[model samples]
Target chain A: MTTPPTTVPSTDIEVRGLTKSFGGFLAVDDLSFRVEPGRITGFLGPNGSGKTTTLRMLLGLIRPTAGQGLIGGRRYAELPAPLTTVGAALEATNFHPGRSGRDHLRVLAGTHGIPDSRVDAMLELVGIPAAARKRAGGYSMGMRQRLGLAAALLGDPRVLILDEPSNGLDPEGIRWLRGLLRHLAGEGRTILVSSHLLGEVEQTVDDVVIIANGHLVRQGTIEQLHGDPATLVRAADPAHLAEALHGQGITAEPATEHGPGALRALTGDMVRIGDVALVAGVAVHELRPLRTDLERLFLELTEAPAHRNRNLTGDATPSTSTEEQA
Target chain B: MTALIRTELRKYATTRLAWGMALAMFLLGAIFSGGFGALYVYGSLTPDGTPVSEVVPPLVLARLVYTAGIQVAYLLALIIGVLSIGQEFRHKTISGTFLATPRRGRVVAAKVVALVVVGALNGVVHLLGCLLGGGVLLALSDLPVFPEPAELGRTLLLVLLVLALWALIGFGVGVLIPNQVAALSIAVAAAWIVEPLLGFGLTFLDGAEWLAKYFPSQATTATLDLFTGVDPEFARTLGGAEDPLAWWTAALVLLGYAAVMTVVGWLLTRSRDIA
Candidate 1:
């Protein structure tokens, strides 16, 4: 839970009218957002919401059909040494089968005139020194991901873009990745990491940009997005609890019935539970507040009926809505 | 450009496939040359008369250079060419490669240069193996232990040209296919199977005689005339009855294939998205 240092650039990445089409279907369309530096921006979306495509376009792997994405006021292809400018791990397993993990990094390091020592240093940094000599084909998915990260860090880049870097990582590996990213950001590098696993990116990201059906649904600080105080409360005496809550002008709905008189209520405040118990003159043994996790927020943001219908009909065209609210 | 070339060389040097192909080419050449030398030594003796020249340079060198230098070098070139570009896409390593450089054109150019250098190296190795095996055969036989400078030079030059062409052709195929398995299969089939079959079939076709000269295998066979000394009658027979092109013309045609394929591959590589 190390906070990113203040030296990290607060510069923002801006995308406008970015559109990409594979034949008749648009993979990314009119999508625009800003990823502020000095903060871990969580790029979250469903499987095909253009997260990977957008990242590719941003990295200049594919040309945008009608728009532009900029890093530090220039396109990725325009950068003199992209490795030194923007470190990226778009795919965790992108490696040549015959090359050793150490050689893989060495080749990349050679591209920017970086020393071979950097390869060894990065390998050790990522905790894969033992596996460095083994061919990349033999590496587990987790080891490949680490090797990819080592490559991304070869030039000591200013910006980092990683997509689902924790796919096959163990709990310890995931935590290690989180710490490493935070440390890199602490050194003034702008970081943008994407993951479908909401819980994985929850504690790591400072801000979040959510998309559904190739449309930007929400973009803001985690505090602004999840700071709202809402909790679920359950109590005994189902009928009495509802009636008592209603008389108090507090909204309460039946969540579920467990036993003869035990009941759960979806309410905003847990304090209301104590008041309800005191007013109803009931002895309360089980009262708990349910906190909102990233999983629930993700579902609420992306599970809209409109999104489902668009995805079903194959019309999830990226709408030209490049709105950004810092 | 230097950095790109260095990167390509580094890749080639470290890959296991390149080493395997090189070793295979060396061994295949040695075995073929040794077997041919043994036969010549046993067969070239005078029955009831004195031996004129016990050493048979043509048979020994031809077998060594053609089998190892031409055939094995071609296979090795194809392997290197395909692996150079095809492996990047196959393993999804292109993502990281482009990420570092982002200049697709330069990367491709480097690959072409690397493949050509590798082809040259293959030629050098083939020459060394030929000389070593030929020298040993000459020593064992009761023939004059002397080498014809002109003939040996011509043979070496032809071997070099064939190896270079092999690499160029391989580069074109690898770029067009951009998959190691597919490129290798196409190269192998074109060399070992398709081109020979096409040549055999074309010889019987009404008007395909002249056209057959342009097929890679036929062109290579015609190009081999530089070493064996062009027999005008044989050239005409292979060129066909209608309007057969000259040996040089056939070589140019094969060169044209290499040029066109390389350009197309370069363009595709420059524009294609790397996954």
Candidate 2:
């Protein structure tokens, strides 16, 4: 066996037209996305939205009904040293209850001729060295999560795919996990972590791929999802303000999310908007740049009517859904 | 392939189930051997100070004592085989197992090799238990402890083969039935109750007596009968086959069961999704 690389080689993840259907129920529907190297990409979806299924397919645990999930342009099963190339913690419960955590890691490690020292190091890395000798069946949810993470990192893999990794982590544990993920991503490793809550990973992830009902809702950098720079300007006379902004080649529309009579100008410059209002003889009450609340945007995108009805249509594509202004 | 086998062996070694099963097999084998040894020692003694060597030969009695526990050992071996794969599915560890190996065929093959080794180990432990208990009783009676060294060695080797084959059968059954509890219950129930009942039932059916010899339990007896030189009258009282098959034929039949189960199990597992 080749030696485990001290530094992870950068590998991007790509899913192209991947679909999985269990009997009549479609789990993941024509899903496609790309996760670049050296970035923490949050695979966000609601419960039962096929995040786990997609990850399993990626790891070759579950065969896709159509299409493929690739790491560094090769299928997971085809990798020469799969464990070294892609380390995955699909769930914390994928462990034998009777086996100790260290033995559990050793069993997996032995498959690739990985040394015992690496297993010990991984247990330490995941902060479970104290409990490594304990049976996994007795492990708490948080401990199991740590054990799962340890098993995933045992191969010192270049790519990490975790499914709902934060499910049982305490606040402090979550912080620790964030730090670990950041450090791994810093090494130019590709990290695809799935979670039902966008807020949980909003700060940690550089990019987000949001899906609902097995269809891609959106896939982009967090900044891109936030959209272009815009300002929320609430004017005393909204119609007059809109006409004034229209004359000046700036579009102003009612900002319903902010409340009635509030206008949203398609520009980020508050000073320029103030100048425009003054020139148009429009009195502005509230003028500030719109900071997108990703939490609310996540809820809106996943719960939208278009997405809810997406499975009903035959011609629906896997392309990103249009972001509706709230 | 070697790595996969090593991983499978480690998986077995790490679990308490393997050790526990081995202990259970040894204890059961010892108890059965002691019970058989006591019966033979008392039954052979006569007031005239002349042993009934013609009624039941000392060599045959010694062979019976040595192999007395194998009846239970083979069943235990089967259970071990079942649990090796069954436990993986029961605990959902199969997901991690597949993730580590990816090629399901290799994983199954490795498991097959590991379980066969485990079965042989179980056979060795069971043999030790039998030797410790039966050898003492035979020696106490002043009878030949190992009447025929060459024959006993061959019999012991076949006993190991029988056990390993039983375990492979269990592994196949475990694969066929992924639910640990269900597979264990069904397999044990069939082996312990259904098989014997069917064997006895076949005796009353005219011309069906020949088919009874193919039963796993009878096959086991027929296989051992080749070297044991068991008294036909005594064997008949214990529900032995009316017409025993050749030892090699019986061994082949047992091997056939193991092969069928493993192949079918592999086929089912090849494309089945882990989740």
Candidate 3:
């Protein structure tokens, strides 16, 4: 807040050690990240992982217990014209059911002195015009989200913050929304969208800030997470194989259901892991080169180790080879 | 600020709930004024031994029927205020509102000023209702059917003042109590149950009779009483014993309640996070 907008106009959003707490429990703990201009940065987390809380703080809906959430380097309260500078749809149902979609946007536009023409344009932009005259209560979940987005865009703001924007959207609606976000970012408008799963936004967002248990667990470009392909192999003694592979300076992750019933290691070359397994006298029941999918990588990075263990072991069998052998 | 007011006005106009509540207010005013005002005021006697049936000094009939209209106007104003302001919180639209108008204080001011206009609308409709009710009953009684324009205008001005204040009170209550249903319930219960009970209970409490004059509803009535005396039965329900305060004094007291609530509510909104 001490910094002026002039200092960070290109950096649309900045969260520096932002923390929030209820009376006893901390909801968001020391989270920090910057949303660069002209990119869709996914704010990914679990249901209670503080994505919404952080977005709320950034929009000035909730006060941060520590640090700051700044837009254009100014606190939201200090943004002389917040509506025109930042348009945020924090939730899908933040509207009156009694009002029409058009009326809803018009009332909001009135607050910022936005013209009526823009309301109509936004209605067309969000593609809810057919339902624009109907009461919002009658809107389907996808329609409500479209209206929410329409309301956010009323001011033609430079930055858009959407929390769980695709919650109730069908695949088609979600595809339409992805196109919208990509188009907005293409025009150099910064967009920050939150979802509980990275796959939900991996195609839409260029960068990612991932959180878990109210803390930043991982963050980087989608390429950074997905570029490093790995290897999957099932061994008769999986834990022994994991330790033996670790001796060669390769980190082995416990296997997920998609893995070939073995430890999954982050590496593109299959020969190195095969050489280590051969040295350790472990039986390689299955071995295959693997590409890291964003969703599995997200789960590996965010879920609790114990939970990840259950996740890695519950469906992981001895080996498909063992079943074939039987 | 003008845009905000327009937005609030539009919000009320577009919502079916607002129109429905307002229509109810208008009908209530009409029935109370025409049906009940006829039974209570048409044949009553004035302070100087003049019959309300007399056509001269239209004050006798104007006062009789306008007083009934004032009570109905209060209820209507309260309803308008609650619906106008309460729904923002009820529907969790306060976030949208604050987002659009980041200066929370301005939203408070806009809400108050907008409700004042709605309050005036309530006044006009209630007046029409009273004319319908009282005019019908007076005609039935063989008294003068209506007051002259000058007398009619004054009664309307008084009723408008009362209704506008009640609306502001409703807006203040809406801000202070964030729950829409709770704020509205308290508003109705205060006017219908709490004020009447307190006024009735304090009537025989020798030293505390003066406390009733300070009640918001009573203060509004007391100010109105300056132009015309209230019913002895109605007055007694409000801790009735003495003449009302000077017209201006009662006006100031009633206004003080509205000013305090509005200003206090504004301060709270300023400090608290909307979430």
Candidate 4:
């Protein structure tokens, strides 16, 4: 037999026209995205926007109804040893209650022929050595999540697919996890971290693949997607400011109302907002470009009525390519 | 495969349920053997109230071994089966299990092998307990000491067969029902109530004798036949079949049930989403 491919050199994950359905409902519809190696890739979406489904399909836990998800250049199931290729924490706490935390790791390690010494090392790595001997049934949700992480790290996997890893963590724990993911990515590991909370992923992830209602909405580096200052503007007397800007053929909507006269504007041109304010003889108290946060960017990209309607009425038909959506 | 099996055994061996089942088997065996030995000793006395030949200690020990092997030891096998598979789903540990070993078929196979090992260990423990308990009782009651090697060997073999069946049945229930309490309840109820009741009701029917022999408990009796030194008549009565199945035939039938159940469970496990 030919030797199996050991390393996925590109560290790039490319998914094309991946679709999955449950009964008659489309969970993921023509989803296409990529996660480049050496950077944290945030799989961002709303609560039911198919983020978890896409991740599960990527891990080969649930087969895609149509299309393909590739880690490197091959599907996840085709990998010789998946544990060593990809480490995942899909659900924070899926463990046998009767087993101690250390024993749980030991059993999982045995699957890939990993030794018991590695199990102890992982327990220490996740900082749960004290509770390692205690039965998993009595562990708190956070402790179980840690143990799950320890198991994921067993094979020294290059790709990490985590779903809401910070769900039940304290502030310190969340900080620790963020740092850990960053450290892993720094080692050239491809990390696909999913979270509905954009604020949490904003600083952690370097790139993003945003989905809404099971469809790809926006995907790029964090700087490219959210760092563009050309579309946002802030000013005083925002209502009059918007009206004057519209008169000048420059559309400006309310970003957020701050005080009596202060308001933020989400427009196609920040430069145009300043010019329109000057031409309309309106005093500009605060004329700065609005920095787009992930949450705001996500809402703007996904809240379009046309997109929402398409998602709601679309049939559960699977698509073979991303172009099918177009 | 050995590693997987060993891991599964470790998982079940550490549980309180395993300990409780073993304790129950030892106690039940001791009580039954002690009671029978006492009665036998009393009945052996002459009309003058002087004792003649006494019941052998090893014989009473063998009886205890047989009863516990059939009843208590077998029950532990069922418990092992249910806990092995059912606990994974019941405690939501299946996700971890699947994540670790994505090949679902291998995991199911490991559980079966583990079940067999557990059954064997329980049988050995029960036998030792019987021998020791019987020896103590005989010494206390001043009974004859005759430990027949053939009888002991037979009793041990019967215990192994019965325990194997119990584990197979328990595993089937665990895989089909995914809930520990529900699986245990169903296995216990079927062994105690449903099969026994159906067997009794079938005895009144004509031409159903052969069919009744296929019932789980009846099949267990047939499997247990390898252990006893009793005559063919005694074996026939215990099985309660007009034409009882051969020991090997009973083993095959039980194996067939286990094989089918395991395959079906594997299929379900493979196809269903772990969510």
Candidate 5:
């Protein structure tokens, strides 16, 4: 990984109205998103939110009931050299218990005429060189995760789709993986990493495609999703501030959760709140737009009732439907 | 195709299951061949107070000795085939396998080729055990140990083919039943328990001979029926049909079974979701 990044063909991932239903239950419903090359897009969803199903469909391990899960404008099965184009590590347990870690990679490497040296190199790259000879059955969860990662990277694939890649990683291992993913994505690779936890990938992904109950909740950059126009205004007199904001056609409610004398504007421009405060003679000590908690928003978007959830329209308001459901 | 086959072969080689099964094949081959050979030779010796070679021709006796273990050895081959595909499903590694090679037909073809090679190796090991154990007993019985070299060569070739075909049948069974325990149970029970009883009934029961020869086990016996060369009368007494299938036809029948199993297995595996 330290060597200069090898030039790899840029590939984008596209899911076009993909839908999958098992028996009568829909797992993925008309989900669509684009993951561009050279960026890490977190495929964020809660457990059983169809993230794994979507990824498996993209890799052609599972067939979509309708629409398509494509890589670089083609189905995964149509790729001339699929391993070289898109490498996926679906689960850590997708291994024979008796096979050694190194042998597992060698088995896959042989299919593509990949050299054994590359297998060893991938083991080293994943920081599992010492455990390469050990049977996978005996591997710790972190080691198995590393081995799965090694197998995924063995082909030097341009695109990597990993499902819960950091499920068993420790803090240190997670950090190491973050660095490694950053390095690989830096090489213009299209990396779609699925996770049940958003905080796990919030700092790591450039863009995110969030789904809940087989429906797309949101898809955008972390910055855009974080650009929640709700402003946090702290004044000496919270009642006066609320009144001034109400007169300016912006609803401001006392936000005791943040702090006393702080008013949270439901949705308004920052300049309008400041101007309203200045004109009304309200002592405005602090006025700044609140940086929305993406984690909480992710939980809210995913946990909220699907029918009433207005997340699809990118509404900044934190839906209170989940609180009602709770 | 060659690379896929090579990769499949590597997968079987990496597991301890294959080696353990191979060891079982050799031991079973040796014990059955040597024990049966010694029993026939010594039993005849004790009854007549004379060498058994005078009663049974050396070529027929040698064929009996070499092939005594194969009845049991072929079961191991079938098990090998079953486990080859069964292990993948049981371990849930089939997803990764399909991911690497999306063309399911190619994967099945490679597995068949690899299973054949493994079956051949098991055949060789079983033959080695037969020669080591049966060869010594034949020599000690005051018989020509290498009786009819050309016939012996044909028998060895048939042994490999029979084992390989059995492995294919096992592969088919594995594919038809992805549950390892259930597949192994039904395959072994059918081959070991039920088929043998049906075979016995076919031999002794009235008006049953026509349907008997088509059974996979019966076809296997007919394919390797070398006794007709040295002693046709005695071979018939041992259950040779009044109008038995030609060795090649019997071989074709066994192959037919393998093909049916493989095609069905391939079809189920091709479109079935790996997850």
Candidate 6:
């Protein structure tokens, strides 16, 4: 037995051609991404898009069918002290039901000869000291999330991998998590959090990796991926303005909800759109650019495949994901 | 290895299921001992027309060992063994356990050690109950109230071995059937009903005694009989008993079951992705 190492080197994660196949179906197919040090990367996809499977492979909970997921140039299984190097919460409800939160953490600590003080520190760190004595079975989903976070952070790990961490958190808990993730990233730690909800990870993540149907559809900084932002332009005589735009060989759609006065150009080249309006002898009332939120960008990039998948499944909503499968 | 074992021991000690089953085992052992002692005090000792007063120390201790140690203690040990691994799958804690120790083989080894110790402790408690209950009844009936030191030590040692093996079997059963409810049902029914019914049914065939002796329950009896040094004359006098295998042969068969179940269970756990 050895004392748990207090210092963990901050390290980046690189997944190279990672693939996972369950029987005949490919859950994560040729997926590749890099989580740089000092950045929070959001692993985003629709349900059943293989987010959890990729995370599990990265954490070494499951063997990859092909390729490798590396943490600081080493496979997770090769790390001498994996708990300190990579802390993972693959599922929020994975703890033993009958054990207290404190005892649960203590068991893991005992394995590595980690001191009792580390357990108490984690309890305090996750704000579960009041409920630490209670059995995990009786905890609410919100509390379970906290306990899961505490367990993941118990070793003061350099890399944190969390799957749908905000699923059970209330608004306040979500805010706290956002601040904490930012703070951890500020400390040069690499964080990979996967979620189906784009809104949840939009503010917290520095980079976003969006996938659909077991394949990467897009990956870049939030700004880099929000290319050719759209703008709303309200014009007098929208029919005549539409003709003027048609004459210029640029397509424009009527702002459906903006009533008779508005048209929207798909491109963010406002100067050209203004020049077009001036030439058409149309007066512009409201010319404002709309900053695309992650949800819209996500839908634009991945919606085609997500829609095709939903059609095959005969369901309107997204299917359940890697957590549901083996 | 010590840390893993310590964690396993703490896990067993902390669960209500483990403590509850242990307490039940002790109470059942004591009650069964008292009942058996009363039967010895009043009922016929040997079917060969021997008087109750003529009952020897070996026979009395043997009956006590068979009932309290083999019958009662073995069942309790099996339940404890099954829970050792069953509860982890039941409560979905295997993920955390495997995460802490990525090598699954280490976890299985630790479970074996933990359950064996727990089995031994339960065996000691069960033996104590038998002594206290049987000793009092013999003293009340004014028969010889004490056994020779050799007889006592041999009986205690046999009880411990029987329990430890039963526990190993139980752990094997749990690993083979990880679902808690399904595993418990199978273990109980297989032990209390299925094996005995098969053993009894096999007796109808000509030259079937040989087949009947290999049944799990009969194998258990052979183990207890061989370990406690049951004499051949006494064994023949009882019409209820069957011809058992040699003690060492019976031991080998029982251990073979444990080893096979363990290997199969480990292989199943190794191949599947835990979700």
Q: Regarding DockQ, does 4 or 6 come out ahead?
A: 6
Query: Comparing to the true complex, what docking class would candidate 5 get?
Result: medium
For residues A1-326, what per-residue lDDT tens digits would candidate 1 score against the true structure?
12224464444677887898888877776888988776788999888888898999999898888899999888998899888778888887688878899888888887788988778888898899999999888999999889988888888777889999999899999999999888777776789999876778999999888887667888898877765444344455667776887788766665443334544455556777788778898666666654555576676677666554254454334422111111
- Give the residue spans of candidate 6 off by over 4 A: A1-8, A228-289, A310-312, A315-326, B45-53, B58-69, B143-146, B226-241, B246-248
In model 1, what are the clashing residue pairs, if there are any?
A8-A188, B54-B143, B55-B143
Please state the error at residue A14 of candidate 5 in Å.
1.1
Q: How many clashing pairs in candidate 2?
A: 0
Q: Write the per-residue lDDT of candidate 1 for residues B1-275, one digit (tens) a residue.
A: 88878888887777787677667666666665555555545544334332212422454334333343355556777666676777887888888888887888888888778777887787777666665665566567644333566655665676667677678778878878976898889889888898768877887998766677677765665555532432345324323223344557766876787778788888888888764
How much DockQ does model 6 earn? 0.47
lDDT of 2 by residue, A35-135 (tens): 99999999998888889999999989889999999999999989988988898888788889889999999999999898999888888888888889988
Candidate 6 residues B1-275, lDDT tens each?
Answer: 99989888888876576667767767777677777667655667666666434555545554553354457678888888888888888877777777677777888888888877888888877776776676677667776555565755665676687688788888888888978889989999999899878877877888775887776667766765532444456654532255677756776777776677677767766655666
TM-score: model 2 vs. ground truth? 0.89
Tell me the tens digit of each residue's lDDT in model 4 across A1-326: 01133334446788999999999989899988888988898888767788888887877778789999998787876777778888888776577777788887877777778888888888887788899999888988889788888888888888888888888888898888888887777777889989987778888988888888898888888888755343444454568777986787665665443334554454446577778878776777765555655565566666555345344564333322211110
Give the clashing pairs for model 3.
Answer: B34-B133, B34-B134
TM-score of each: 0.83, 0.89, 0.83, 0.81, 0.89, 0.86
Score residue A213 of candidate 5 by CA lDDT. 78
Evaluated against the true structure, the overall lDDT of model 5 is 0.85
Return the TM-scores of chain A for each candidate in numbered order.
0.81, 0.81, 0.75, 0.76, 0.83, 0.81
Model 6 - which docking category?
Answer: acceptable
Interface RMSD after interface superposition, each candidate = 1.0, 0.8, 1.4, 2.1, 0.7, 1.6
Per-residue lDDT tens digits for candidate 3, residues B12-113, read 777886667667666777776675555444444444544433533455555556567566568768767766667887777888888888778888888888
Sorted by lDDT, highest first, which candidate order results? 5, 2, 3, 6, 1, 4
Best by DockQ: 2
Worst window of 10 by summed lDDT in candidate 4 chain B = B49-58
DockQ of each: 0.61, 0.82, 0.63, 0.43, 0.79, 0.47
Instruction: Give me the runs in candidate 1 sitting further than 4 Å from their true place.
Output: A1-11, A231-290, A309-326, B36-69, B142-146, B224-252
Give the lDDT of residue B200 in candidate 5.
74
